[model samples]
Target chain A: MTMFTVLEGVAAPLLRENVDTDTVIRIERLVSLEKVDLGHWAFETLRYRKDGSDNPDFVLNQPRYRGARILLAGRNFGCGSSREGAVHAILGMGIRCVIAPSFGDIFFSNCFQNGVLPIVLPQAEIDKLAEEARESAAGGAFAVDLEAQEIRTPGQRTVSFATDPNRRRALLQGLDPIATTLQRDGDIESFQQRDRQARPWIYG
Target chain B: MPGQSLFDKIWDAHVIADLGSGTSLLHIDRHIMHDLGGGRGLRRLSELGHKLRNPELIFATPDHAISTEPGRTSETTPLSSGYMKVLREETKKHGVRLFELGEDGQGIVHVVGPEMGISLPGVTLVCGDSHTCTHGAVGAMAWGIGSSELVHVLATQTMVQAKPKRMRVSFSGRMHDWVRSKDLILYLIGRLGAAAGSGSAVEYAGPAIRALSMEARLSLCNLSIEMGARFGMIAPDDTTFEYLAGRPFAPEGRMWDRAVSHWRTLPSDPDAVFDREESIEVDAIAPQITWGTSPQDVIAVDGIIPDPASAANPSRRHEMELAQRYMGIEPGRPIAGTPVDRVFIGSCTNSRIEDLRDAAAVARGRQVAKNVTAWVVPGSYIVKCQGEAEGLDAVFRAAGFEWREPGCSQCVAANGDVVPPGQRCVSTSNRNFAGRQGPGSRTHLASPAMAAAAAVAGAITDIRQLA
Candidate 1:
């Protein structure tokens, strides 16, 4: 587990709504790929044309957005599939944080597990950040301090956020959750013993 | 406490530790995995020097990455075979139970879990696939988890989870014969967009849900994940108990009685208050089909393509326009007569024997329309054998449909089984996301019967009208 403190980098705006995992990292690219920089295959259909050149129409393909470490995306980002490959692709692209109005429950959780911070902000705030990102693609950097629960815009504007305190602590300390669960092995043992006796059917 | 919703009851019971603010460490009763996603978790566990805490609670099978071709072996498909090889080797090394191809228990994780009675009431089940919600129909707290958590659960038979808000969707009216559970869910998603159930665990109740068989309830809960809900469930009832009675892994005799006694107490109390409540009138739900990329981009079989100008807002209008261009369907054209080039009638969502019977009923005496390729992959080897014994496979074969073996076939298109680029396919799988089946392929999600009807008609047609 990698500890997260703050990420300060260029924020690219991917404003399309309902950006499903299939679009995030198409299932085709995810099937037999090696453990490499999957960012090359992220958003395969949208980022590349049939001839294999960059689809100039895609936001990520724009030269100004290169090396972006923060993503300002639309609602329901990572909406389909329980694929962590989507996160692998997002991180592969060097994106360390994502700001969205909302996200699919599983995708949001996966981001945290993979050391990427998923920040839920109001749509108005995201729209504002998206605007700032486009304006500052060359010289501006968006900074997010997970410890302070705040996102710093390119214009040095501060916006606050909220997260479950323990998850936040875990992220800050880079603690594996299973290790955290292991600290309570006695309780888990008690649960297993009681659960088995109480409901023996599921055991079969 | 006495009036708690089933969601609350399950969540409260499973919490091993409350890591404040709504997060809790949940004791996982069952953790299932498959070929495509399970191998990485095993590698991570080995790397971390963590022996599986409870190998007995873990089940593995090769479904997502196995070929559904008859007589297919690992060598037949290299990409899928590689994943299956990893699954076979890892499960063997770990002493985890695995159902490989040609085995009786071999099937899609969801189908095999419930069919083997491993997914029972009052348990918390997690799987590496989103359609794992299908097992929630048997009154369990079941949902999908990603690869990262799969490793966590493998290392420690528990995972930390955040409590989601509770939602109850009541379908108060009686469904018509042609309106299967698939139609009801499509109608729900169509009426409410794909994100309607986001961040909530939905419980399906009311007369319509209760009237459904265990298979139908599974179909409904399966798509609940499609709408962005991590999980969905129906309270266990006599229907569930009866369905699990004689299954291979189900308990027998007095144990069955004790299981029933516990299951009957798992329903939500009458006075329970849901965080959110929704109602759907099912009497008027006709056979439905998707016209565009999203499952929510659907219409009744008789309806026409939606005009973007009629959209309520610019964002929605933009969505309509995108779906229109991608699907190559013009506005105002009736969806019924839209020609289809392919038909796929199998997926975790609708590949059970009952689902096969639905398609078989439609394809019994009809030949698949010329130039339209169609296939029928059973949900499991058990289902395939049963279908053959009951002549359901013959009905499909007689209709010019290729009767294939069991696995997650073209549903995910992992095994080189894909709809060609620019081809129109009516499929029974859940998601209609762009490029979900294949790049540049247009998929119109439908019920098994509806997909079968489309195969014969060479176009989308209401199943009721076909009869």
Candidate 2:
């Protein structure tokens, strides 16, 4: 059974724009003969220093963001290459909701298909949320409400955002185009049967 | 009082019977596949004990993992031997058309399809790779499908999909010199903030589009996925027809006339309505560059890195800080003159004739910077042959840029050649995400001309300066 909800948790707080899939997760990792704990390598290069030690300067390592679930990212958050491993790593890390100024075209679709809810907010709102996350890091536990489209911090400082109506409907219903299409199984099967009969040379 | 946009016409035409749950079965005409992800789909087919339902409708090629190094003993050694062999074997097993290394059709899957006249106008095309949208330049409805979905398409020759809302992105006015389609796409991705086209298909229209060469149109449509669009397109016009006319698969004689007639009528009716519309003036555009990790983190060539401290939004602040740290950039710093260790000009995005021509123009009399290593790869065998015939290879060689074999080299580091860790590269391919070129290799997405300029300058120099 699939979990019914619009989103889960967000881990990426930095909203750098044009984040291509190749960078989100490197191809080497994809071909690696290693078992992956998605979170273990979530920004593997950034989190690791030159000598393979933890880079204390990285955002994810900061004490304030120790357990942050929501990731706030810049526009085109997933761009470049279309390796789905980027989405897999993010989803595998147990992140459920990603609030971004925008997402790469293919990565956005991959997120929804993998059960991650990608929320888009205005640049201004994104800036505010990141600030709020930073300021309330000491307070511990920043929460986002998908239903209300509001991200609230400990001090009750809230930022509101908007998702595309159609996308929002799809995410909330947990219906990908395939699952949604299967709902019309009868019509599709009939069409398929007709198409096969008409183009018997092409269809099996 | 609503006017129809090109996107709306295509979307409505492709709609099969709608399933009640806000999704429908989309009728696909042509499906393109590449080695990287198609292997899994083929494996799944074997698991199901089913032969491909419609092998003729599908075509597969090896592009992603094929090593760029010439004279390599085999295609398997550089990457995972098992996966590469899987790709080569499955296409044979399924009896789909295969374009291996020795085949003339061999190139980036996106480039191979159109160059061979396989991607026709008004057809719904799907590839296992994301850049399949490149075919949309010829007015085809194309999108990338995942591994599991690829298996579904392989088995059923159809995909269950939700109808996307349509968006018309019209470019008005003339483009300035040095502002190619790559810059225009980067500009759009920057302006619309990447997700602007989410859940929608964008149709490129207006005077600017009609004026572009078919190759330039492909470059523009190729990056639609970067902007969060399922696909992007330009209505089939004379440029598209002319490019397809002499190609191998394109209909000849009277059939050609009929095909053109049908393609001419493929545009959206004036009365058709789009869910959204946006317009841009090419005159206002500039050669663009991506400053941060995402495509939306872009600004004009003369722009500066955005400072998160001064940002108004919380996410922007976080993004700014992260970008600054990851990219080793400081606040309020300009993007120009950023030193680059390497330059790469080739990919599905801008490795065609026009892109090579633009780069060759910059390389004509100039030499590459001694400190910079550059590679210029053609989009396809045809493109490579044409460039060699035109002496673009000599111009590049004279400028100290290595002329590379056609494939997606260094685009995703799928092939062996990648920027060494911590090295910054100016690349003509799309995406400037952190470590995109390789692990710990920083990539800055730029136009081929800009990449050539960077090769000459050994840094991120604006192409306009050279112009």
Candidate 3:
């Protein structure tokens, strides 16, 4: 069974909106499928040099915000194309949860299937998280309790937000829509059998 | 649920049975298979020792990865050939209707369905491609399925699904000149932030929607997936009837009368409720072009690229920075006049005959910019033949754009036809994600005419200026 639980950890901030799948993993950094390295790809063009060294100018390389897990992002996160590879690259990079104001529709569903908790917070709460992440950029550690819906900053200030009940359950259970449907497989089978009798042409 | 709504009627009729815990075994009335993801389903069926259960309910076509390179026959594109072979093999084995390359009905599955009156209203349509929503323009309840589910559909003509909530996008006023359904949908996607359609199947209604031609309606629903909506639709009307009147698969003579009567009853009642609602004024919107990586990261032709620092939300700021750096554009730089190395005007998105005519109208007697390489591929072999017959190809060629063979070129870049790394391309196809065109390449989404105008101007220029 896939691991499904709330990711409670220091939120690492990669605050961006409309991040396309390609930037999450560049075509160059990828050799054949076997040489697939996840960390090297997450924001590869943004964080690394042509020679593959850490760009001191990159946000992740900053001393204060090291080892952050929760990616706090803007509205419509993971927008543009419907590349599943982007989801794979992010999940592989140890990003357990993403707190965004919004997510690209396909990407959000993909995250659920692949075991990424995408918490959609109100813009106001996301603003607070962004501010705290920015302010703690020097010290770099912030706490987010996914179960508590609270963000704990360096100075111990906590912020709370709301998430939808159904989504919360699905994320916590790691139950994708397909898996959820599979839970009622017997019922589905009975239904299909009845349907097949009615439309025998469809059942051959 | 009787007499509730067209949405409710279709939903309940198609739902074979309500499985416990909110799942349902859905009876698919129409199944469209394209080349991209459907081949994997064939492989799965092969491995499982399964033969298709209902081939008549299934229809297959070659689309994605089909090459548009002129003089390069189907033999050159191996991926497309492989996909086509599998599709052909399965269709023959199962007696499913196949729209092969030489078939008169061949085209983008979405385009072919409507033109042939195969995408009927009140049907549940399933396809392996996301843009199956395009079929929903005729009021069908359509959604894209994954490859595994596609196999299930192939084997049973039914797949298990959970119902999605419904949304209504209302547009009340008559659209202005030069702003077609393509622009309206693009503007809505830009305004609603692309993901607004998430968790919902959108029913597009209102005066503006009722005013669109069947082709225009198809264009609107085509990009529904681009905005996170599983499907987008408009209710059937006289326009739908008029378009389907003489099509090959449409109801004939006496059956036509009954079909029109049924199609007339396809719209939702006044009291039908939607889980969400979005309203947009058609007049206020302008031609859109994607600037950043995401389709939502768009600005009007007259607008500037958004600055990360100007963003109030921190996550937005970070995304802006990443988009800016990758796109190689400065903050606050106007999208118009941004240098474009290439301009592509094709794909399932805008490769229809009407779209080509629109672009050709703009390119007539005009020359492409010295620096820009432009391609104008049709959506099908039929379109290509018709274009050549009508001398539209000559118009494009005269304008210095290569009039290509039909395929899904430069849209997903699934084939080898891609822009070189780091170059910026103004494409008429949907999705402008970074590296979408190629590794390190940038894509700018626009209307077909806008792509033509940009090809001429060598940058992102408003088609209105040329008009």
**DockQ: which candidate is best?**
1
Between candidates 2 and 3, the one scoring higher on DockQ is 2
| Residue-by-residue lDDT tens digits, candidate 3, A113-166 | 566777787777777776777776354456655567666666677767665555
* Model 1 Cα lDDT, one tens digit per residue, B394-441: 899989999998888888988878888888999999988887778888
Q: What is candidate 2's lDDT per residue for B7-98, written digit by digit as tens?
A: 55555555566544556567677888876787767887888665576677777777777766655323445564555678778887888887
lDDT of 2 by residue, A101-190 (tens): 667656766676666777788878777767766665452456666567766665667667775555556666665544454465566566
Give the top-scoring candidate (TM-score). Answer: 1
Candidate order by decreasing lDDT: 1, 2, 3
Q: What local lDDT does model 2 show for residue A99? A: 77
Candidate 1 docking quality: incorrect, acceptable, medium or high? medium
As for lDDT, the candidate ahead, 2 or 3, is: 2
Model 3 TM-score is 0.82
TM-score of chain B of 1: 0.98
TM-score of 1: 0.98
Error of 1 at A151 (Å): 1.3
State each model's CA lDDT, in order. 0.88, 0.76, 0.74
Query: Which docking band does candidate 2 fall into?
Result: acceptable
Clashing pairs in 3: A12-A68, A12-A69, A16-B319, A17-B319, A64-A140, A65-A140
